[model samples]
Target: MRKISRGGARQGPGWFARRWTAFWMRFSGPGPVGKLASRLAAWLAPPHMDQISLAYLNRRGYIDATATIYHSDLRLGQNVYLGPGVLVVETKGGGPISLGDRAEIHMHVLFETGRGGYMEIGPETGIHPGCQLKAYVKPIIIGRGVMIAANVALYSYDHGLAPDISICDQPLVAKGPITIQDDAWIGTGAVILSGVTIGEGAVVGAGAVVTKDIPAGGIAAGNPARIIKYRNELKNADKINE
Candidate 1:
């Protein structure tokens, strides 16, 4: 076994060791005991390339076998969970990535930051499976206790569409950061474009393409995400009818 210094220089396992670990991870087995064993192996065995401290593991933070994290400045809070097939990767000129305590990133989610971009996921937030958060030109900040459903895509930058330039060669531009305030709920398949702020306690309906800001306690739906109603309005309506 290769000696891994806790909080030391980031050095991953050799090709052979990585291959063996991948092979070993395949037999995670079928029941509760098997699941427990697999989680333990994922937390203990394989040599990680990032600066994930052993103390985080001891605090019950779980990173699944298939997850890939490649951030230069990575910080993990207590009991954070990175589920299977999750990828935290940097593209070009990437910046810091931090996850607050008890943040859960579910299966198959791709979190990418590049071009001097940064990202911070707050505590008690749960990002469901198949979500893609691509940050560039600005940071993607997800506040505490937020719930983001499956297939939600949030992009913090847009490409410059000059007529002469090929779309592939276009430069990335952004109005500002993508901020999701505390306790917001983003529905499945929603696409949150650059510079939009989803305010605290707001709810975005499924399949909505948000291009503008959604105010706090607002209920937004449809393409371009119109603010359908405020949550407080619903409560008031109920009281008036009674």
Candidate 2:
């Protein structure tokens, strides 16, 4: 009978042969032992390339098997979750991309950063599936506890269309940072352009194209989103009636 080697080879065991035999016996069997063997094999097996790359981002975070993260300066906090098909890319010389603790990025979300541009999502923020976030010259900041619905687009740069140059060739321009303050609710299909701030506790309606800042506790909805009501004001009115 051929002796099983330490490295799973068919050869006579040399040094530390007893240790290898004991280790194999502990993890070899049919029921519970089979389960332990499977787990050990998985743990010892080499991870995929994407998994290896994401390990540099955050050891504590959970990245889906289908997610693709290109070479980037990624800083992910503890308990951060990246869903399947999520694509995160950093252009050459782009700034760091950060996701705070408990930030949940849903499936098929795309995050891109251009040269010198950064993107940050604060703690406990949940970005729904199919969202696109791009930062060219300025930062895109999503504050803590923000809830962003599916298919939303947030851009921190706009293309310049000079009559002298083609629109596609025109240099990207940034008015300022795109800031979505804490506890804000962004509805589905909303497009938030650069230089706009969605204030704390504000709500943006679906399909709105936000151009200007929405005040705190304001509710805005439209093609060019306009403040229709303030949540604090509504609460005050309700108290007066009571």
Candidate 3:
């Protein structure tokens, strides 16, 4: 694979492509300008596969010519944008992959599902470039209005850690699925593990390794992701002062 520089790192062209896609997405909603922008985006970056027709996706949204997708069950909603070099591939015993309306999957982002695993992305959710979501034995469900920054990784399965077993021979296992609730913000380089639920309106700081559930409206950072504060806490404090 060819290497590209992004954000002072070796991340691929995801960030650059996302910037353009997002700019175009702004006007892809409703109205005359939106229609024009939608048409322009479709013309410039149509879906690259014969599996999805130009006419079908043109009415929906834009998909970059460089993107590669191969799934037996793939569902895309209105105004969805898939940026450059995005890849969605099915592995062993894969399941369905669904993207809600206005979902934006940026450049070089990868979605891999296997072992009856699946992925469900809600409306208006934006997943930045260089991010990866791999599901196995469970589903990765991301709710509406979620913002996942670049290089974030969500894995719903892990290898067994038995000491006597060889690393390669160990079976895959999962505590549970990964669920990110509505309006959550996941910062760059975050790693979300299996069995984790990030509640609605929560904020996860950059580079955090989340292993547990983050309550709704909570702000969390650091490894294991402890709640630093809750948004309601600030609101309560303001009411007290008043």
Choose the strongest candidate by lDDT: 3
Expressed as tens digits, the lDDT of each residue in 1-242 for candidate 2 is 97665677534343344344334334432235433442343243234322232322333555654667784588888767676688999887678889998788887999999876899899989998899999989999999999999999999999898899987799989889999999999999999999999999999999999999999999999989999989876755476557
Candidate 3 lDDT score at position 137:
96
Model 2 quality (TM-score): 0.73
lDDT of each residue in 1-242, candidate 3, tens digit only: 75545554534455555455556655553345655564455453434332123323344666655667777887888767777688999987999999998788887999999986999999889999899999999999999999999999999999998999999999999999999999999999999999999999999999999999999999999997899999877865466557
Give the range of the ten consecutive residues with the poorest summed lDDT in model 2.
49-58
At residue 186, candidate 2 shows an lDDT of 99
* Candidate 3 Cα outliers beyond 4 Å, as residue runs: 1-57, 235-242
Q: Which ten residues in a row have the lowest lDDT in candidate 3?
A: 48-57
Give lDDT tens digits, candidate 1, residues 61-177: 666656777766778887677777888888879888889998888888999999968999999899998999998999999999999999999999999999999999999999899
Clashing pairs in 1: none
Alpha-carbon lDDT of model 3: 0.82
Off by over 4 Å in 2: 1-59, 235-242
Ranking by lDDT: 3, 1, 2
RMSD of each: 12.2, 12.2, 12.0
